[model samples]
Target: MSKSITLDQPDQRNLLDRMAQGTIGKPVNRLEGPDKVSGVATYAAEFSAPGAANGVLVTSTISKGEVALIDEASVMGMPGVLAVISDQRMIARPAQGGAGEAPVQQVKQIDYWGQPVAVVVAETFEQARDAAKRLKITYNADDMSDVVLNPEDADSWEEGPGTETVEQGALPQAMSEAAYSVDATYTTEGHNSAPMEPHAALAEWDGTKLTVHASLQMLNYNIDELADSMGLDAENVHLLSPYVGGGFGSKLGISPDVAAASVAAMQLGRPVRVVLSRQQVFQSVIRRTETTQRVRLAADADGRLQGFGHEAKVTNLPEEEFAEPVTQASAFLYPGQDRVLKVEMGRIHRMTAGSVRAPGEAVGMQALEAAMDELAEESGIGPVELRLRNIPERHPSDDVPYSSRRLAECLKAGAEAFGWDDKDRKPAQRREGEWWIGTGMATAARIHNLSKAEASVTLMEDGTAVVATDMTDIGTGTYTILGQIAGEMLGLEPSDVLVRLGDSDLARGPGSGGSWGAASSGSAVQIACEAIREELCDMLGCEDEDLTLKDGFAIHNNKRQSLPELLNGRSIEKLGKLKPGETEDDFAQASYGAFFTEVAVNAYTGETRIRRMSGAFGIGRVLNEKTAKSQCMGGMVWCIGSALMEDMMFDHRDGHLANCDLAEYHVPVNRDVPHLDVIMVEERDPAASPLQAKGVGELGICGGAGAICNAIYNACGVRLRSFPMTPDKLIDHLPEI
Candidate 1:
C-alpha cells in the first residue's frame, strides 16, 4: 500500500520528538563508513561488463564554429583501434537544460573551447588515448570572428530570460536623503565543482535496452536526460549509480562521458567504458559563473538600512540559459523599504555556467556582506550591531511573514562564542611580531526549498526493517540519516535498519541538489514508517495513542510484546510520497547563520593567514549532530579557499581555461585552514516540512567568505574589491608598519 501527503498546511504532530528509540538527532556513525574506508565499496567505473572496450572523448580546440570534417580513416587503421563515433547526440551540454527537458543537441556546431566533438574507442585504454590525440579535426572558424570571449564587453550583454528586476519604492530619493551610504563594486572569478570523482561511465547495450553505471546526482532527472539524448524510452534506460564518490554539483547532469559511452556502445553493438581525466573534468564540466556586482546601501545615523540595491552581471555560453543567480538572498536579508535588485547576463565563449556549491549566495553574499562592512565603518557602528538592527521582521519584497528566522540568535551566539569585541574598532593598532590581527563577522542565508520525493519502508518478520530510496549520499551522510528516521519511527536500533540507495529501480527520490535531499527524502521514509506503526496498532487491537514502541518491543497498558511475536510471520510494506504545495510559498523560509573569523596580515609580504573561525547556524532541525557539524566545517573550509586561493584563470585570445588541472589551479589545503568551531542552534518549523528539517549541506558556505575578506581589511586597512585577495593585489596597497 502507498500513502501520500501534500504539505499544504503546517504539520504539528512532531512525531520524531515523541519516538521512544531516542536516535533521531543523535550522533550516529555513518552506516557505510566502514565500507567506504575498507575499500569494499564499488564506484561507478569499478563495475565490470563482459566485453567492455575503452573510449576517449575528443574535444574542440576552437572557441566557436562548425566542425568542417573529422577524418575517421585517420585513426581506424591504428593498432587496436575499433571505432570513431561522432554522433550529434553525444555532445549535448547536460547542465544547460531548459525547464524540465534535456538541452538541445549541439550537433557539429562548437559552442566553447573544450566542447566534446567526438569519441574514439579501441580495445584498450592506451589505444583509445593514442587514437583520440592523433585523430585530425577541421573547422571553418567563420563564427570565431564574432565570438565574444570577454564578459566585460558592454555591447554583448542581454537581459537574461526569466530573470527579473525587483522594485519596491523610490530608491534614488531614499539613497540621496540617507545620513550614511555605501556604493561599491566587487568582482569574483569563476570556480569549478571539483568533486573527488571525475565523471566516468560504463554502458552496455543489449540491442533493445541500455544499462549504464555512471557517476551522477539526481538520478530521477538524469534518467530522462540520458534517455532523451540517446533517443530511447525512459523505461528502457537502466542507470545505476549505487556508489558515487562525490558530486558537489559537478555530476548533477549527464556529462560527455556518459553520453559518449552510451552512444559508442549502441553503435558498436558492444559494451563500452568512458572515463574523463582530471584535466578533462576541469575544462569540460559546468563552472560557476564569474560575477561583477555593484551594491548600494543607504542607512541612517544609527545604521538602520533605509535603501538597498544589488546589481550584478554574469556570463554564460550563447545557448545556455543558466546565469548564476547573484542576488538570491539580497531581497530579504535586510529591512530596506526602498530596494531594487537586477541581474544582467553577458554572452561569452566559455564552459557552460551553472550551479556550483551554493550558487548565488556563495559568491553573492561575499560582496553583499563586504558592502555592509563598509556601511558599518561609515556610520561609526559595529558590523555585528549594524546587521542586528536591519533584521527584517517580514520579507521586504514579498511582504510575507517568515516561517522561522534565527539570524539574530546566530549573530549573538557567534559573537559571544568568538569573543568579538565591538570596542576595538581601529585598524593596524594590534600587532603580534610582524603580523596585524583583526576580527570580522558576516551573516549567512540560503533559501529553503522542498521537492517531491518517494521512499519505501518494509518491516520484515525477523523484527527488522528496510528503507529503500534512489537518493544518493554524495559524502553527505544520506545512508545514516534515512536509517535513523526509519529506526526512530519503528522502535529499532539504527544499525538494525537496512538502507539501500543510489539505484534507479527503487522509489525515486528528489536527488541531492539544492540541499534538499535529507529533508525531502527523509520525510517520505518517516511517512512510510508511520504507516507501519498504524498497522502494528491495528494488529495489537489497541488505540494509536496508547502504543509506545521501544527496543524492538511494543508497549501498551504497561505491558510489552516482542515485535516478532506480534508480527506472526507476516511482513508489512508501505510506500510514502511527498508533494509540496501552497506552504512552499506561503511563508518566507530560509536557513540562517553567522560566521566570524580572525586573521593576521603580514605587513611586508601582504599575505593573510586565518587564525581562528567560528559559525552558528539555525537549520530548522538537526538530523545528525556529527554530520551537521561536519557540513558547517566543510563550508567554512570552502570559505577560506574562496577568500584566499581559489580562482579559475582563462586564456584571453582563445577562451581556453588556463588552469586545466589541479597542478595549476589552487584550493585550500591543510596548511591554509585554521581551527574551526561550528554551533548548530536547532529549531523546528512545521511549515518547512513534515520532518521539520531544512537543508544544511550548502548553508555553511553561503556568505562565509565575507568574514575572511572583512578581516583582511581590518588587519591592514586595505580594502580591495577583487576576489581571492591575491598577494599581488594586496602588496601594492599594504599600509606601512
Candidate 2:
C-alpha cells in the first residue's frame, strides 16, 4: 500500500514521543561506519566494469571565447591513447544545485578560463592525463579587456536583472530620525565547497540504456540532468551513488566529468571512467558568489532597532539565474518597523556562482552581525543586551507568525554556558604578556525548507525491517537516522533495520541539499511505518493509539504477540510520500542559534588564535545527537576558515582563479582549531516537519564568523570590513601598546 500526505496544516500528534521503542533521538553510532572504515563500501570512482577505459578532460586556457580547432591527430599516436572527444553535447558548466536540467551544453564557447572543452581517453589513468595535456587545442579568444571580473565595477554590470527587493516602510526617513545609526560596507571573497572527494563518474552504455555511478548529492534531480544533457529519455538512465565522500554543495548537480564519461562510453561502445583532478575540481566546480554589502541600522538609545536596511551586490555568469541571496535572513532576523532588503546581481565572466555551504547567510550574516555590533556601540549598550531587545515577535516585513523560534533561548543559554558575565568587554582592555584576549558573540539563523520525498519501508516476516530510498548520505548520517526512525516506529533495534540508499530504482527521495534531506526523507519513512502500525492494529483487533509495540512485540489491551507470529509467512511493504503545501508559506520558519568565541591576538604581529568556542542551536528536534553535534562542529570549523584564512583568489586581469588547489587555498587544520562545545536546544515544531525537526547542517555557520571577527576587535581594537582578517589587514590598524 502507498501512503501520502501534503503538510497543509501543522501536525501536532508528536507520535515519535509516544512510540514504545526508544531509538529516534538516541546517540547511536553510524550504521555504515564499519563498512566505511573497513573499505567494504564502494564510492563512485571505485566501481569496476569490464573493458573500462580512463578519460581525462581538457579545459580551455582562455577566459572567454569559442574553440576554433582541436588537433586530435596530435595525440592519436601517443602511447596507450585511445581517442579524443570534442562533442557538441559537452556541458559548458556545472548545473546549479537543484537545477532540474543540465547547464548550457555548448562547450565550444568558453565562458571561463578553465571550462572543459574535450576529453582524452586511454587504457590507463596516467596515459589519459598525459594525452589530455598534450592534446593541441586552439580557441577564438575574446578580447581580454572586455572581460568583467570585478563584480563592483558599475560600468560592466548587467544590473538588476535578477535582483530581489523587499520594502515595508520608508527606511531612509526612520534612519534620519533615529537617535543612533550605523552605515557600513563589507566585502567577502568567493569560496569553494571543497569537499574531500573530487567529482568522479563511471558510465556504461548497453545499446539503449545508460548506467552511471557518479558522485552526486541529489540523484532524483541528477538523473533528469544527465538524461537531458544526453538528449535521452529519463527512463533510459540509471544512477547509483550509494556513498559520497563529501559534497558540501559541489556535487548537487551533474558536472563536466559525468557528462564527459557518459559521452565517451556511448561513443566507444564500452564503459568509461572520469575522475577530476583536485585543481580541475577547484577551477571548474561551482563557487560561492563574492559579495559587496552596504548595511544600515537605526536604533533608539535603549538599543531597540527602529529601521533596518541591507543592500548587497553579488555576481554570477551572464544569463545565469542563480544569484547568491545575500540578504536572505535580514528581512526578519531582528525587530524593525521600517526595513529595506535588496540584492543586486552583477554579471561577470567568472566561474558559475551557486550554493557553497549556507548559500545566503554564510557570508551575509558575517556583515550583518558586524554592523549590529557597531549598532550596539553606537547605542551605548552591551552586545547581548542589545540583541535581546530586538527579537521580533513576528516576521517584520511579512507580519506572519513564526512557526517556532528559539533565538532568545539560544542567546540566553549560550551566554550562560560561555560565561558571558565573567569577561572584560572593552576593546584592548585585557592583555596577557604580548597577547590581547577578548570574547564576542553573534546570532545564527537559516531559512527552513522542505521538498517532495518518498521512501519504502518493509517489515519482513523474519522480524527485521528494511527502508529504501534514493537519498545520498554525503557523510551526513542519513543511513543511521532513517534506520533509527524506522526502528522507533516498528518496534525493532536500529541494527535490525537494513537501509538501502543511493539507487534511482528505489522510491525517490528529496536529495541532501539545503539541509532538508533528513526531515523530508525521514518523514516519508515515518509515514510508511505509520501505515505498518495501522496494519498491526488490524491484526490485534485494537486501535492504533491503544496499541503498544516494543522489542519486536506488539501489545494491545494487555494482549502481546511477537511480530514474526503476527506476520506469519508474509512481509508488509509500504511506500510513503510527503509534499509541501500551504504550511510552507503560511508561517515564517527558520532554524535559530547563537555563537560565542574567545580569541587571543599578538600585540606585535597581527596573528590571532582562537582560545575557545561554543554554539547553542534550536533546530526543532534533533534526530541524532552525535551526528548533529558533528555537523555543528564541522560548520564551526568553516567559520574559523572563513573569518581568517579561506579565500578564492581570482585574477581580474583574465578571470583566472589564482589559487586552484588546497595547498594554496587554506582551511583550518587540527592545530588551527581549538577545543569546541556544542549545545542542542531541542524543541517541537509541528509545522517544520512530521518529525518536528528542521535542518541543522548549515545553521552552525550562518553568523558564526562574526563572533570571531568581533572578538578580534575586542582583542586588538582593530575592526576590519573585509572577509579573512589576514594579519596584513589588521597589523597597521592595531592600537599602540
Candidate 3:
C-alpha cells in the first residue's frame, strides 16, 4: 500500500503572490503589544498563585574559601520567616551528574564572589530579604589564589572541550613571515544583560506534581533540568514562560533563582516566588565573560589573505565551566591559506559568566573586523574594497557551497548609502573645533541554524485557526511572525489566526536561540498549515490541481466554498514536524551583512561620538520588514555600547566585580545614538528550507563593535586596543596629526 500523497498547490503559483495576498510581509502589530505596554503582561517575577510565599538567597562574601559556619537561628526567628535551608542539608541527595565531562555538583568551597550559600523562605518578600541579610557566615580565606586575566596566566589552565591552548611566543613568529600583517590585541570588559525584569520564578507543588513559572529561553530544557535538580520524574514537572521583556542571551538556561524558588516551595508545601534584587541580579544571574583577544592577519601586498589567526583568553569562574569567546567566526569568514585560531580559558574567582547577546561573535568581531580594517589601511585600499577582495564564495573550513551569499552586495549598498566614498580619510583633516571626523566599515555573518520542531494547527468551525508551539517570543516579536506564517499558509487574515507559545504542554518547538526562532518556528507553522489545507481538499473531493485557498474559502472548478461550510461542524487538525535532511551536509547556510559607521572624535579630550551608522543585510527572504529592520537597528545600538561604554570592572584586590550595577556599568542610551539606517537585501535560497528564510537576530550585531572601533582609529591616529575605548585611554597618547 503506497502512502497517500497530498499536494494543494499543484497549479503552480508564485510563492510571493500567496505571501502578498496573506499576512507574510505585512507590518502587523504584535498580538501581545497592548498587554506588554499596559503593564498587564505577567513576567516570571509577577507570577502569583494561592498560598504563595517569598524567598531570598544569601551569597558568599569571599571569592575563594570554605564556609566555616552559617548561623541562621537569628534569621529563622525573624517575623513571618518560614524556613532557612542551608547547603549542608541540601547536599544529602546530590543532583544527578552532568551530560559531559564537567562536574554536576555545586562547589563545596566558594570559588567566586556571590555564590549562593543559603536560601530563606518567608510569608513576605521583605521578610525574606531582611532575614537573608541578617544571617551571619564566616569563610576560611585562601591567599594562594590569583586573578586570571593576562594571557600569561593561561598556562596554569588545561585545554578543555571548547578551548584551545597556544604555546608562548608563537604568535609573533606567524606575523613576521607575511608580506602584509597587522598585529594587535583587543580587550572587552564583562557586561550583563540586565533585562528589565530580573530573574524570577514561582513554583507550586500540587500533590506529587510540580509546576513552575519561570523566565527561560528553552522551556523543555528548563523542565528537564528542574526535574533533575529536584530528583523528580520529568513528567511530574511542568514549566511555563508565557512572556519575557528581553533576553539577549542571559535567560538561555535555568539560573540559580529558579532552583532556589523550587526548593523553597517544596520544603514549605506552598507556592513561592523568588525575585532577585537589582543588586543580586548582577551577582546571581549569568553575565558575559571578559576576554583578551590577540588577532594577527597575514595578507599579500595586494591584500589577498595568506594566513589568519586569533588567540583569545576568557575569564571563567573557578567553579563554573564556560566556552571561550574567540574562534567562533574564524571557521568561515574569509578565504586564506593557513588559518590558526585558538581559544584559551583562564579561571577567575568571579561570578559565573555565560552567554550575552551574540556571545562569541560579539567579542570575536571586535578583534577580527578591526584587524581587517587595519589590513585595508596597510594595503592602501578602501575597507569595502579590501573586504570584497577577501570575500569567501563558500565556507573555508568545510569546503561546502553556500546556500546563499550576498555580503558583497550588502557592502556596496551600505557604503553607498553612508556616503563612504566621499568621506574624509585622513585623521584631523576634517576637524570641527576639537572633533575629527572619519568613517569606517566592517562585514558580518552568522550561520542559518534550524532544529527539529513540531507544531499543531486546528481549524475551528468559525473559520478561525489556532496554532500552538513551545517556541518563546523573548521580546523578539515571535508571536507576530508565527501568526504571519500561519495566516499566509492557511490563506487567512492576521486577525483570524491565534498563536500560543512558551508552554511545555504545547507541541515542542525549537525554542529561541542561535537566531533560529523565526526561521525554525515559522517553518513549523507553515508545515502545519499546509497539512490543514490538504485535509480540507480531501474532504471536499477536489483534485489538488484545481483548488485555490483565499479569504478562508476553498475554490474548485470555479466553485467557492467557505471553510465553515466545508468543515460541516467538524474541526480539522494537523501536526507538522521539521526534521533534519541531507541538506545539512550538502550545503552551508549563512546570513551576511555589512556594517558602516561615521564617528566624530574630540581631538583635545579624546571623547568619541558616533555621528551616523548604517547596516545592509542579505538575510534570505525577510518575513517582516519592520521587525527585521528593528532587529538590525537594535544590534547596531548594542555594538555601539560595546565599543564606547559597556565594561564590567573587576577588583583585582578581592576578585570581586566592582561595577556590578548599571550606574557603574554603562550601556548606550538615546542620547548616545545618532541617525541610523538599515537596509535588507531580499534574496531566497531553496536549500535553506521550504520557506527559504534564514535567521537575522545575531547578524545585525556580529560586526558592529568592530566598525565603531575602526572608525575611532580613523578619526584619531592613536590606536586604542582595549574596548570601552574610553577618553582616559586615548588622552595620554593623542597624536599631533
Candidate 4:
C-alpha cells in the first residue's frame, strides 16, 4: 500500500507547509555539533588499524621526464625502513577534473613537479621520515618543457573546444552605435581551497580485501577509483570517510597518498597510515586555475544591454580534460542579441588545476561584475541600477524561460537594507581621520543543479525514524537538516530521528558538491517518508491526503492513533529513489543574490580593510536557517581572502610553487573578518524539486569578491585589474590621488 510521486513537472503542492511538525525551516543547531566541538568525532587516519605501519611519501623535484634512477639500497638497511615501494601498480593518482579513470603508465615518469614518486614505510613515523630523507632519487630533467607558468609568456593560443559564439543583429553595428560601452581585460591568479583538514588515509589489508579510511568527499566514486589505482577490483576495496572536516573539492578523487598507503599495506601484510604534511597537501592537491578575461559591453543611454562579449584564457595541464569555466554565466546573464565570446585553455604544468569552492563563477563573476561597475560609471548610472536594468527576461543564447529568477528582487532588497540610495556617490567623499569610506554591490548568480539520490528510512517500533544515506556533511549541517526533513514528514521530533551518514554501504547520494547534496538527498528522504505515510494511511483506513502526522501520532477524521501502537510491534522499512525528470528540461533554474560590502582605506598607506558585509539571497526554500547563514558567512570569508591576499605563487623558471605552506600563504584571521549579515528569501521554486528547495552553498561565494573589488575602487579610486588587490598593486596607482 505504499505510494510514490514522480516529480516530472512543476509542483505547487507546498506539502511541507501543511505538515503538523514545524522543524523543516527552523534554525536547529547541527545534530553533530557536540561531537565536533568536543573532538570526539573521528576523521581519516584517526582510527587505530591493526599493526598499522607509518609511511612517508616522496615527491619528484623535476617538472618532467623519466626517473633516471632511485637508490633503493641506500635506505633499505636503515634502522626501521621496512619497504621502499615504487612500481607501476601504484599509478599516478586520478585527478578529479582530469580523465575520470587513470590507466597504468609503463614508464616511471614525473608529470609535474612535486608528484609522488615513491613511498617509504617503517615501524614508526619518526623512522619513516628519517629514512625517507636518506634515500636519493635522480631524474632526467626536461629543461625544454612547454610548461607555461606565467600567462604573459603564452603568446599563441587556440580556441577552446567547447566555446560558444553568438552573432545576432550585427555585433559591430551594435557596438559602434551604442551610447555607452566598456572593453577591458581582467586577470586573476590561481588559488587553493585550503580546507581545515589535510588529506589523510589509513589502509588495512585482510588478505585481498582492502579496507580504507580516507578524508574524501565522494565515497561512492572513491571505492572504484581507489581499486583501479591499486589494480584491484571494486568489490575487494571498501572506503569509509564517516566524518570529513572539510574537502572543498580537494578530496574529490583518490589522491596519490591513498594509493601509496594501500600499496605499502598490501606488500607488508599489515595496515599502513599516511598523513600528508600541510606543505605536502598544498603541493599535491588540485588548485583553482588562473584566468584572464576580456569583457566588452554595449549599452543604450538607459543602461540596458545591447551587446555582450567575453573572452577568457585559462591554463591547465596537457593531460587534463578540464579548464576554468570563466564565461559560464555570460550566455544568460544578460539579454543581448549581438554578442561574441571566446575561451582558451593554455597547456601548462603548474599545481594540478580543478574545482575549488564555486569553481567557475567564483572567479568568472569577479571579472564580469567588475566590468559592469565600470560600465555603470561610463554610463553615469548607479551600480545597483545598472544591474537591475540588465536583468534577463529569458536566456539570451537559448530561448528558454526561467523556471524562477529573483535577481531583481535580491538587488532591490539588498539596496534597501544597505541604504544604497542615501549613500554618497562620489569616490573618497566620506573620510574619517586618515581613512576613506565607500560601499559597493554586485549581483550573485549560480546555475542550480539536480542529481539522483537514493535513501532508506525505517520507522522503528518505538516511534523513531532512522535515515540512511552516503552524503558527507563537510561542515555544512547535513546531519541536522536531514534529520529535520525526516522529522517533519514522519510523526517525530528532530531529536527522535536518527541519521547515519558517510558510509558507502548506505544508499547512494550526490555527495555534497555543486550545492546539490541537500536537494538530491532530501528528495529521497521526502519520497521515502511519503511511502511510509501511505502505508500508515492504509492501516488507518483513510486517504494519505487526509492524514495528519504529529508528535508520533496519526490524526484523520478527528481520530488519533499512536504510531508505535499501529506499527504492531515491528519496524517498517521503506526505500526511496530519485532520478532526473522532465521538470529539469521544462524551465531554466538558478539561485540568485546580491552582495554588498563597506570598506575603509588608509590614505597614507595602500592598505584596505573591509568594514562590514551583507547579502540578500533567494535560494528556493531554505532547509535550516542557522546552517544556511553559516554557509553564507564562510563564503564571504573566502571573498575577503580573494580580494585581499590569496594566491598560489609559482617560480617562473622551474614552475614550482614558491609558498607551499599556509604560514606564508595568508587566509582570513579573526581580525581580518568583520561584521556580516544575511537575509534569506524563500521563493518557493516549484520547478526546482518536490521539496521546492534550491542550492545556496556556493552561490554566496560566486559574487562575494566582486563587491569588495568594486569597493576598493570607490575608496581609493584605483581599479587594479589583477587579482588580490594587494598594497603593492594599489600603492603605485594611488600616487596621483
Clashing residue pairs in candidate 2, if any? none
Flag clash pairs in model 3. Answer: none
Which run of 10 residues does model 2 get worst, by summed lDDT? 92-101
> What is residue 42's positional error in candidate 4, in angstroms?
0.3
How well does candidate 4 score on lDDT at residue 491? Answer: 65
lDDT of 2 by residue, 271-292 (tens): 9999999999988878888888
lDDT at position 108, candidate 4 = 74
lDDT, model 3: 0.76
| Total backbone collisions, model 3 | 0
Please report how far candidate 1 places residue 601 from its true position, in Å: 1.5
Q: How many clashing residue pairs appear in each of the predictions shown?
A: 0, 0, 0, 0
Instruction: Assess each prediction's global lDDT (C-alpha) against the native.
Output: 0.88, 0.89, 0.76, 0.82
Query: Comparing 2 and 3 by TM-score, which wins?
Result: 2
List where candidate 4 sits over 4 angstroms from the true fold.
1-7, 92-107, 145-147, 155-169, 422-424, 735-737
Sort order, lDDT high to low: 2, 1, 4, 3
Candidate 4 weakest lDDT stretch, 10 residues: 98-107
Query: Per-residue CA lDDT of candidate 1, range 1-737, in tens?
Result: 98899999978899899889999889999999999999888898888898899999999898888899999999999999999999987964443242221234385988788888899999999999999999999997755557788777636676665677898798888899999999899999999888888899999999999999999888888887888888888789888887788777788888889999999999999999999998888888788888999999999878898999999999987766777778989977997899989888988888888778988889999999999998888888999988999998898998889989889899999999999987657777778998988888899999888889999999999899999988888999999999999999999998989999988889999988888998899999999988898898988888767888888999998889988898999999999999987888888888999999999999888888999999999999899999999989998999988889888899888889999888878888889899999989889988888999988999999988898888988988888788989889889888876
- Give TM-scores for every candidate, taking all chains together and pairing residue i with residue i: 0.98, 0.98, 0.93, 0.96
| lDDT assessment of candidate 1 | 0.88
Residue-level lDDT of model 3, residues 1-737, one tens digit each, is 01111222111333534543456666778888999989898888887798899989888787777888778787878899998876432221213432111113363567667777788889999999899999888788777444443334544654434554433334355567777888788888787887777878898987698888988887756666677777788789888899976777767767767778888878878998987777777876667877778888888778877777788777666545566556677677787756667776766666767778887888888778988988887777778888999987777667888878888899989988887872335554567777888777888877777777778888889888898988888888888888778777766876788889889888888777779888777777777777776777778787555567778887888888888888889887788777656676777778889998989888788888999999999988888888888888988999998899988776666656677777887888899999889998888866666677888888888888889888887877767778888899888877775
lDDT of model 2, residue 420: 87
